[model samples]
Target chain A: MIELSPILVTLKLATITTLILLLIGTPLAWWLSNTSSKSKVVIESIVALPLVLPPTVLGFYLLLALSPDGFIGHLWFYISDTPLSFSFSGLVIGSVIYSMPFVVQPLQASFDMVGKPLQQAANTLGANSFDTFKNIVLPLSKRGFLVAITLGFAHTIGEFGVVLMIGGNIPEVTQVLSIIIYDHVEVLEYTQAHYYSIGLLVFSFIVLLVTYSFNRKLMVRL
Target chain B: MIEVNYKYKLNNFLLDVSFTMPENGITVLFGPSGSGKTSVLNLMSGLGNDKNKENNSKFILNDRVIDDSVNGLKLEPWFRNIAYVFQDHRLFPHMTTSQNILFGFNRCHSELKPEVLIEKFKIKELLGHYPEQLSGGQKQRVSMVRALLSQPDLLILDEPLASLDYTSRQELLPFIECIHKELDIPMIYVSHDIKEVLRLADYIIIMDKGKIVDQGDIADLCISQPLLTQQEGASFILDARVTKIIEEDKLVELDCGETILITAESMRLNDKIRVLIHARDVSLCLSPPQDSSILNCVPICIDEIQTDENGKLRVIAKIGEQTIVSLISHRSARQLNINKGKQMYAQFKATAMIK
Candidate 1:
């Protein structure tokens, strides 16, 4: 029978990583879109580092940072007495960083496209920044949010190098689908590897297909 | 009065303008394309950032301080309650017409009824349509309604007719006039078009090269300052009261120091109006020609003879207390022996613009 623990762990990790990325990415994206500061390009390049740098390089640095004696890990050890390296939480942090650009770029582009003219118009109409963002900017960037969520979730689910380096193989904890598939292949169990590999392939394809088709219809309507 | 004193620095121009406008009626910021007219409007409404905090600026609206750089206090745009009607409409594209108009009203929690302006602006049918679905004129009408429904203390219209075709501009003029008649809110209208300035200005603030060239009452400025009329050549405003309506001739007789007749159909007896007469239309003669086909001859004693910017001699004259200007050739001025305090009959056609 096909096991469910690895599959559940992968979904859980992907969901948590996407949610955390969204929480931080939104304001960062808004700032990137509106500001003309000198450090804007620097921040943009830093956020986009994940798209170009190998995931193993990022994962290696994260693993070192989350070690028992490392600064972040030492703080966590003092607070909770649990090591961060090879933990599900550590994997979550890694995935969030790895998926940062996927979530931010789309949102920044859409916010930039909505532009300052509309915001200025709203301001004169007695709507403050938050109100205008909620009513005007948010509604207009619906497609951006959808695309960002899909790409972030799917990217994390398909992660291999970063998860292997940071999460390690801990059953029912961080032995996610990508790691399990790697295990099955190493042991020459092609059937088990096929089960997870085919599943992920189909899932990623369906998620992207739905997002793209939905965006097209929305584009036409708008 | 709404007083403004600001020194804003743009890329190529350092704007230094100081002017006061009446709390009511349309105050026009009239100037050419790159004269920092829109820049003034933006700064006055607090829609623009000063960038240079050291530059002192003060804006007082009827005793309430809106912007004071000395105190380092500048009210945000929303806090100022000044609505802006942009030339591009700037309507929320995602919303229907109904939603867009109600967006401001609901946000401001205005006590004014939207339906009144809805019916007045004639946008009731367009309530279900989006801004992209409407025509250029229709979009502007909706934007005007949106701005008015916000219940703002002040409204700024920045060249509302600049983006429209000639026919659409003509079509939208009456709605603009309707706003002046129906609302008591103070408005600052910016336009380079002299026609709009003449038709709508109660107070005029003329700008050129980031400086206030002149500012005063429109009727007073029309004759006193050549900057006001230099666009459409030279023109003058004459204060007159309608004395008679000749139905057969479709003309109205005005008592302006001297009697003048103009072809205005909808005029009543004793109705006070201002007549806009172009100086080019007036011809000077030594004596009043009674048998000529041209109508309305008024005797004007030349106040001064000055050369306008175009190398044309402009004879400034007065009839009673009101002034009338005439653009005559040097040969005609000499032929008529026009000199300071010289009495001459200024004859013109009956197509005077009575407003």
Candidate 2:
């Protein structure tokens, strides 16, 4: 029987994380775009912290929190004995945290570009807030949302250190392509490592190419 | 009635303005640049609450308290039953003409169909077009219709025609005039153009440097103080009885009071038409020249002389109760020794009068 490929785990984690991020990020970005709240700066600073912080620092905190008898682990234990760490779910949580800025900032910037005048005009026209956002703001800022999604997907696929801290190597579960390639190198299996490493290089390049090209077309249309 | 009493300071300009406008006709707020005309429109529209709050004023509309500093009553813009037609014609670029019109309807009572308005505004054919596709006049027409479709209690036209070209303005003026005459809603029209004010306003409010310099009926204000000098320079409403059309000279003869003055351009023999008389066009002559270039010289008494801000002399004359203005140099004022109780001939430069 053929062995299950290790890369499938990373793909699943990236896809799920991207979907979750889009759901939460769209509204957060919309709020950041339209809100007059004085606390916007504070929220913005927090969203941006993940972008600039060392990946290992985030991994260290998440690892401690998700370990058995830890903050999230103990709470999760009340529901079930199984802790979140060293599982597929743990990698998803880590991926989402690591890839958040990629999803949110683009959406916020796009929403900002949509501006207040059009929304106010929409409101004056008898549309409540939801209708205004759906009809006016959404249509206007679609390109920004697309950019956010592309960046989010790409960023999630590239996560390594955070996933490593929470998700210990477990083939078909948590042993993703990056960790698999590392394991291959540690075992002096250079050929297998070369295969996985080359695959990642090509994948990231293609994703980036798609994003930049789409952005170029958007700029041209604008 | 709409009453505004507000005082605010912006940069070096202090805006202290108050006026009570009639509820049923077009009340024009006329002023020069920096006269705070736009500010008044903004305040009335709720787009200017911050400034209005800073100034601490009151705005009452139709006995409904809109902005009252004492009571702390300030309504949101959407709640105000006043539709503002801005000078820029802020049509949503992403929206079609029909969509824009529909937007206005959405803000208003849902009882009326928006298509009825589209038919009324004569924009049915242009509904599918975006704002960028329409001409300036068409866009303005669309904007005006949009404002009206909202079914506002009072329409606010903030220089709606200010951005259009001359021909476009001419095209749109009749629609505005018709709206004022035929529509049920009252309107507050703001403009600095005196000609527009004269043409469209039923009641005029004159402003200068953030103050109400004068306010009254257009015809009465034309004949009254301060405003008269400016009007005189370009103000003559001649009730010309067309005795006969002199086709040879292409001139119309107008009978004003006891004088039958001949104008170069003639009208149909029995038509009574109004013509404007300009003050600078009228010259003072000690005696009427028999063989001269001056066509219409009337024998009259010099009524009085008033000076402008620049101290230029404007000689007000009387040929019955009708007073005519003639601008002369201050040097001429001294040389002619022009005084109130003096008799002089009022000679006019025929071409200075425009419609």
For all predicted structures, in order, the TM-scores are 0.93, 0.76
**What TM-score does model 1 achieve against the real structure?**
0.93
| Residue A52 shift from truth in candidate 2, angstroms | 2.1
How many backbone overlaps does candidate 2 show?
7
Candidate 1 lDDT, A63-147, residue by residue in tens = 8889998888889888999999999988998999999999999999999999999999999998899999999999999888988
Tell me the TM-score of chain B in each candidate.
0.90, 0.71
In model 1 chain A, the worst 10-residue window by lDDT is A213-222
Worst lDDT 10-window in candidate 2 chain B: B228-237
Candidate with the greatest lDDT versus the true structure: 1
Candidate 1, residue A136: how far the Cα is off, in Å: 1.5
Against the true two-chain complex, what DockQ does each candidate achieve?
A: 0.85, 0.33
Writing each residue's lDDT as its tens digit, candidate 2 over A1-222 gives 123467777778888999999898898888887677899989988888878898888999999988886788778777887778888877887888888889999899988887776665554444567877887878777788888888888787777788788888888888888788888899998888888888889999988798789878866554
Residue B173 C-alpha lDDT in model 1? 92
lDDT of 1 by residue, B134-243 (tens): 99999999999999999988899999988999999999998998898789999999998888888888889989999999888888898777776555545788888999
